[model samples]
Target: MFYFLPLLLLFMTASPNTAIIITPNEHTFRVHQRAQWKILLPRDYANPFDPDEIAVDARFVGPDGRELVVPAFWFIPGRIESEPTTRVATDEQLRQASFTVRFVPPVPGAWSMMVKVRDTERTQRSAPIFFEVKPAPPGSRGFVRRSPKTSHYFQFHSGEPFFMIGPNLCWANERGIAQYDEWFEKLTSNGGNFARIWMSRPNQLFETKKLGVNRYDQDGCAFYDALFETAERHGVHCMLTFNNYRDLVDRDMWGPAEWPNIPHNAINGGPCTRPTDFINSEIGQKLYRNRLRYIVARWSAYTSVACWEFWNEQTFTNVDIPPAWTRDMARYLKSIDPHQHLVSTSFGANSQHEVWAMPEIDLAQEHQYFGEGVRDASAPISAMARSLWEKFDKPSLIAEFGIAGEGSDIKFDPDGIGTNMHNGMWASMMSGSAGVGAMWWWDNYIDPKNLWYQFYGISQFAKQIDWINQRFEPVTLAPIMSDRSQPEIFADLIIRSAGGWGKSHGKPIAVLPNGQTSLGLPQYIYGTEQPRYRTQTILNVGIPQPTKMVVRVGKVSDAAVLRVVIDGEPTKDFAFSGLPGAPGQTKVERHPEGKWQAEFHQDCELEVPAGKHVIELRNEGNDWLAIEAVTFRSARSSQYADLETYAMKNEASGDVIAWLHDSESNWFNDRAKKMPRTISGARLNLSVQSGKTYRIDWWDTWKGRVIESREITATGGGELQLEIPPVHRDIALRATRIGS
Candidate 1:
């Protein structure tokens, strides 16, 4: 009876373990360009299972269709696992199993892996599970790198400046993956090269206390990994923000406790002070380090990583913590991996002065939201950058700069947004600093019509600049003016080459106007009297007679390399100096009537000579200069005004206004389509007084429709006049509201 009892017990235990078996989980692996793969398992399987105890081995295949085996080893679970695998008791009714495998796919392609589990006692094996791998798609293609020894900009490979033309994308998880995909596609197609992905603190990625067990529990991490994979595939780089303002230690880490607080206002609610030895004391840092280590070690092998942003707008909050804490955290990251990738904080400020000064920082990042009327804030901001460059002498990048636009108004005058960005970029580039132009609300929040078009324009401009860097050598210039007076006179020039001699043999020059005058270039003398103010006219010199000269005016940006062609021929390279020199037979001369005119050879060609031309005379090396209006002439005569002429007529005023046409009156006729209706019939009459500015607002009741609004300043009369468009139906008028 005793012997039979022992055998019965053994049979019972073995029976449960033998009958309950799990087949390998089938997985489809898809990675984009420059991405890697990693698989996590349950904690029970931390140690390798005996071959006889398992049904199948986990194997991964490469792009070459070859199988690669992962080394099996036990790892400390840290905060991810609560107990050691050996501590877990096994019974016949159930047995726990866990393990993990990691692999980095070098290129884009379909990949497969097989997972099988074998039972030794039963001599049975589970069916093989298949998984696929994908590479980074067309638009996405870079990764972030971090270093401790130098600032973030130095981390980027020299000559390969990381230019991110992207938007601030928030509420990603709430938006879901499909919307994310569409947004990514739109941004990438429109010339956006990167996305700033946010990860709130107390999120699932940091919940696990142990590695294997906790990693398995990280659904958020899994979701983001998928998104990262998608971004990589799309050729879009991601600046993954570690935490948002609400999730920080100094703020409410959980819930919307401060919902009513104004958006950029600083509110300290959470435990702002962290332990001195956080990594060694708190369980969270260990988990954080582990997760970060895993992330860095895995993602570092891919080229898609352009930079690793530490936090988003952390400087805005008044967190009571020593600066060394951040410094240490940065040091810890660099110790694990030293790659040529930039590491920075998504902080809003003149980063060149504050953040760049931190030993832990690489690039200077800032966010600008200057109001509408003060459209040219870029000037001062850029001037500050120049001062910072001279002071710190480090590489800088404008991490963020944008404007709040309702719709098409913001799009066209995106100059309101673009000018600031363009000027900032110009300042950075001309000052030898890396520039990152940011678009706010391109996706995720405000859905604007022609949003993609705006992005495309910015992207094209950036690409042109990039092309310039590839083609010509970059030579920086000193600011022409040190004072705020006559900002229009400051000019930044990039000359292709120096020293020229003839009409056809003169060097070509590219000029970017910063202030009123054309830098210090040469001006013609009409009658040897000093000119009162600098003008946008080219002064002729060394001419013996009144002669016709072809002048060209074109848009030149920091992001593009432009080639100037006179007529059908290219111009010779020339240096960009504040002073102009006489070339070849080109001479400044007075007419028989004692009037001076500049002349070019009859065979000289001109590009963009369609606009009206005027002649100006100035004295050589003297303050005397005079402007004379000449007859408007063009090679192709036409009475039609250019598009700019028409647009200038409808420019917005201080008060809110809308452009409505009578083409479609449904917007005016449909009541159900109007809610908080700000637009209606072709003619919109609203009571607006003079000297007041109103905000234009609208809502689209349709499922995926968009509503737009523009503001018009009141001319001081009791009635507000507006040119309405017939595109929309119902309209509601609201007085301008200010002061929250």
Candidate 2:
């Protein structure tokens, strides 16, 4: 009862009994629209779910006879998989499946494709099938890239700078699809053009799935179909990220990324013994290439799919040495994709090894976190962006970042994790990253906190910037914090003198009737010079040091000894010898407990490790000693910029971008608390021509709107000043040279 259509039967499995179906034997599609060629066959003929075992390609011949080969992957419709264990596709339901390639014609006119299917044992070909294509809709320029313009920015194939600014959104359940739709629609309504769609891990994949190992499921593909359709309608582009590290996250026997949950694991009756094994094994390579074939054939046709990122933080996996694997797979992707959409890989670590700097990557990607350092998250963000943007000298992206802690302990604040998500985007933009930093924990943090507005604000700022035509370079600026006498002074509010807080300082302390009062921080007591204990000192004295040194202490804890860390390394039970006496005195003292305690009357002599040293005096639980005085036998060190601020000028146009950043907690959105005027007054100091008139526009980080404007003439050739407005969050500015 079956009819044989051999003339155009370009692809079929090795088995002669199976049937192959090609829909729309003839076709017509507009440019940038998909033309799907589907080949269906019985399960006996090929492994529908095994991309490694089944490979197909359709070589489309343009009007001028230029053939562009596009691959095809398996797809079969099924319902969404949810909680409570269940199976959607029965063996009979998977008997017949399809290999599909949805390609959008790059150019309009008459076109034809020669379909080819490669089975494990044989290859089958189909005769030419002709089609016609039309021009794309108005206002559509196509996929993003950096070709045709060698600038440090991403531009569409049509050469418009694609300054992307959006969150990393993975697939949401049906109930949440509406939310996603609204998010995408709103983003477009406010000028956003880019986002990242994560494929998630094995058990959590919403875009790709394996139905009982040998058969594929179409539900994931269907979700993307509607997702991409909606994206095209809203003009939102997507960065389709492949397997995240969670795929092989085998921390335990059963968890979010358990081995049994991953169908591709060797224990699950598939290829590769471990998570890292898949990256370098031959069988793993085949499976990966097969997935690429499936993805490239299915999604490459649409301009909406911006780039195919192979891995999300590859280093997060056991594959610590993954650069080679990255290079291999990246090269494979480059060899297959027809549209040549960008190809990139992100590292969980702040930076990539030199191998990542290879040409295979289109974007130098990095992820950053805050709270560990004394500075705010923005400082590291701005540094990572500007650093990689210049070092790679290619387009760089802060693919993932926020105020979360590192590794498994990462915390996501449903309340928005302070203004970190806000500041990260603005800092990244002005720091010269190819796009505003894409926020992670999209569903939990971005959506719930309504942080998407930050992108809209970033998009607004981006629209005003002609990053495509006018390239810029970040300029070195003066330190945000000039000088520091003591480590504690850098704190927002320091208790230097115990005379209680001065009246000018917010919330004055209570004064006693006897004309004497105590500040909450005893160290702040005036005149008496109450000691501030538990301090750290990191220095680069820049000179060689002797084997012994002495420290003088004005205050002490009779029983408890402090820890003195040296040369960036910490040492415990560092008893002050209490010898060499005070800076000007000489004496030795020992307490009843036999532990040497630093005395005000003597210089506490301690052995100084040779070479450069960074000293730290930590209180061992008790109020041990104060950093009232330190007599380092070596020279004193200089101060580092509390913030890593920089500026860049657009040569073609006289406009400039100044990025100033601080990683102070007061700058963060903590427990929904707002920063006070004390957190204000941050500034951007950049090199400018003296006497030149410049129009400066202060940017609001969260709102992405201008807060104020001023015209200032540079007073010197070395640097010029622009004050940060009184915003609780980070700030940026765009300066245009009017005249000299």
Candidate 3:
């Protein structure tokens, strides 16, 4: 006698009739916990990863009599191999073929499951297995979800607010899982709860090598399993990023290489001949879908995997990601993933409204890297966060952020005083972002410098408020500066140009050696037609005195030179000498022969009198140099305090959370002095409920605790005035309404 269920039957294929053995890891499991079963099918089949050849699925009936179907994926058990320097472990594969079904039990009840194997000839069903699920323990908040009450915040299944507060743990270095273990422990201990992880480059779990076509790297898979397990243990939610633009491009900012090693290339007997082909071709889509199926099957059960980001800076890819591609891929991914995790993708500091507006992209994301011309890093973060939130009316994420795009600022600030890292975190949170700005350079700077305390401080402060139900809106603050004679310097990036490989006069030009071929350049320089190697603009010097102009040049090739011509009179040539590293050096490594030896020099300065004059920057040497950003110093300095304020108010209850930042107390300004000028007497004025009493707690952003407290009542004027305490760099304050 055989028992058959209609919904449970998936696919049947041809194969030799053989016995299927199923062994349960445990007969019972707790709700929200992973329930797995080991399965062995004794059948000889070529390409077990191909569903056309072999398909395996697990079907289960929950306590509510609802049927749930989950796919089964190949898994090979492995041991960890530790790297001596960082102790980051990689997988040492063991040769054994097996399949497993992993699922997180949703509810507490008795459930029954059956495994079905399908092939061309016949479909075989294993004996049904019964299991019990116990209720989850107290304080166990389920997976994160978009709060039903708010558009810009996240909440757990239990309706508790989940404010993400951590940096990007993109990939591990030598320390691998062990590194994550320490990192997660430090993060969670500091009250941090989120991390953005990339599934590309270094230790990616996908099939990238030629021999691994249609088959995932078993070692990589095992590494991820351990990584996720470690993350879950630390209670850190991971934004699992799938692909990066670097995976498709042959050359990037790092320099020339053999990117043809990927399995998708035509040379590897795959479907795509060009990078764009993968997004346009049917076969490529099919291949991607297969990979997605395997990914969801293997890792969807882990609650730690919060969001599924499709790509990291997708616009940087050689082929632009069409909205249809994102729409179709996201739709396909959602269809198979029973968990229905949040889906997102990122761009290079620009919003792709067409794609982000789609229902598939749950969150709008961008990566922002500021140049040296930027005074305060957090200013852009706050501006971008507010722009994204208001434009799309959705939660936003600054997925990758840093002082410089190329590398960590550790090379600049060797003392490791993380001013940019700290300010960016508080700024994003207060600026209506879904979470703190996820900073980049984790391995080289953040982790090594032990800056987990910054994340901890944000986390501690976030725990005091209800982000989901508060319905917080940004509040405009009126500041009363105590110091009226503080000299304020007006700084701006005067000349911004991108030099690499771009079309010039309808012809392709490679100005810088080892530059990315697909890199885009501005069509017109400063609104005037100009060649790629040169830019001309009229400088209407407004100040009455001489202004200092600093030309920051980068991406220099051998024998490259830059000349500034003012009023048709050319200045002395600024020559490059053996690519001396400074300003933008992320790492110290010798360039391979025949490739470009790039240099970073920011000391080229020129003084211009206050008058209207035409200025031109021309590459006069045999090679070329990129004008990254030209900064100008104003001769006239205004008197004002450099303090900045951002606040959010709960409309329903007059509660407010605010932060005050000393704009001048930044890494660039204070790194050498190692001191931030303390500001004494200041006042904050904001509107509140008239005649309402409120209690304010001023928090120390660095110490992660309350430094001062005060009680006040709003008068009939409806404006509450606060006497700001002595602030060094920045401070957080929470004003909660007292009584009804």
Number of the top candidate by TM-score? Answer: 3
TM-score per prediction, in order, is 0.44, 0.70, 0.78
What does candidate 2's lDDT look like per residue over 551-631, in tens digits? 444445443354556654656454433433534323346655454544453345566655544454444534344333333
lDDT ranking, high to low: 3, 2, 1
lDDT scores in order: 0.37, 0.59, 0.71
Full candidate order by TM-score, most accurate first: 3, 2, 1
Error of 2 at 144 (Å): 1.7
Q: In model 3, which regions exceed 4 Å deviation? A: 1-20, 81-96, 122-128, 483-640
Candidate of highest lDDT: 3
Estimate, for each residue in 166-253, the C-alpha lDDT of model 3 and write its tens digit. Answer: 8899888777898889999999998888999987876544564534357665556767888899999999999998887787888877
Candidate 1, residue 536: the lDDT equals 29
Candidate number that wins on TM-score, 1 or 3: 3
